[model samples]
Target: MKITRKDFLRLSGLSFLAGGAMEAARAIAGRSSAATESQSTPVAQSVRWGMVVDLRRCQKEKGCTACTDACDAAHNVPRLADPQHQVNWIWTQPYETVFPFIQNGYAEQSDAGIPVPLLCNHCASPPCVHVCPTQATWKRADGIVMMDWHRCIGCRYCMAACPYGSRSFNWVDPRPAIAHINPDFPTRSKGVVEKCNFCEERLANGLKPSCVDACPQKALVFGNLADPNSEPRQLLRQRFAVQREPELGTGPSVYYLV
Candidate 1:
């Protein structure tokens, strides 16, 4: 006489089959109730997505390259024989050069001592979004800055607008140089600008970004900044971190641990 949760679900399924008219009426009532609840709940709008990069945990032993590899493979990023022709959608850049001002008198430091992973900062006030003449780049309601390749006129204004040097233009046909390709992520055509999308496709499906999932050391944390309960916001609240070019007032969502 005592039905467990699983047993109750099973019984409910059987009842749907047994009472056809009643089940249909219940379904309609359930839908109406759901609508009522939805209207009363006041749907949450406005999300500020952000990331936290823990430098203390990132000592290069983690082989953070896995994130780079996953992103490159997913996007079908091309490899160039010449460094000038090389294009990186998401890759590591020298920490010293990235923070040259921070270097001060340490210009000759070895690579072993300094390493930084660079990607689209996904600024709250993204300059790329502002400079795009065709409105090719935009920030989504969920706080993701995305690109519309079809609308891009290839003027490279976004590239100039970006202070982080995150945007890359396809000077040549990238498809020919792609060693491997992932069908899930679309590749950009030549004469178009592309950069990190924060794995928007994955985020849309209630999944974490590929880079966050791929990081072995768990250094990168991504979540909604608006929700204080989100992992990223909680991490930021608990940890002392720094944002790249904070004075620029771009309001970068990405944060770094020093």
Candidate 2:
């Protein structure tokens, strides 16, 4: 029996997830397939934001909380302690699970705990937008997949449509779970689904995503995938990178270098 990539992601299991912010991102990515989209929009630039994760650098790191903590703090994401209801805007996964399509030697990457940071891919053709009855999740003009929390009906249809299992529902009020509240960030109420928005708010303010800023190992890179001179494009051209579940045709913007 072959343990396929989908099977690997299923086995990886996500126990925690955090709240809202991804709607704006989903709207952008949901508009087109990352590989095919022209990455055009009116209000936004001709930019397609993407990420690159270098396993070699990530391997040297031992702590997984840096990215997660920064994301939570920047976005006011809650720390749901309950295993049944924990929320994660960003988290870690084993290398084997992150790149299950690759075989044999890749397992070595998981030797010292792969702990690859995982988040919403902001796929060019995000399925989350397709299933959204209220257009809560849609692709933005700049090619980010975004979510409108006010528009979401808690249908979880987007969650089911997402092959990456990135979306998290608010089963309870998330305020009490927060250790420190960032007054600038908005909080999510119960019965809403939220995920990483690739820091749309920060981007609007001319800043990088919180996770990218906080990674001490410098394992993560963020840029406009459409720009040939962008860091992400340069890395993709020079290094061997792969996306999670490419077979699903989501055209994820996030790439991983092993």
Specify the highest-TM-score model's number: 2
- Local distance difference test scores for all models: 0.79, 0.84
For model 1 the TM-score comes to 0.77
With a 3 Å backbone cut-off (N, CA, C), the pairs that clash in candidate 1 are none
**Model 1 lDDT at residue 98:** 67
Clashes of 2: 28
Which stretches of candidate 1 lie above 4 Å from their native place?
1-45, 60-64, 104-113
lDDT of 2 by residue, 1-258 (tens): 999998877665532121234655676676546523543344445688999998789778776678898999988888887867877788887766776667576456445356878999999878898788887888886677888888889989998999988999999999999899999988888999999999999999999999999999988999998889999999999999999999888889999987
Supply every candidate's count of residue pairs whose N, Cα or C atoms clash at under 3 angstroms.
0, 28
TM-score of each: 0.77, 0.80
lDDT of 1: 0.79
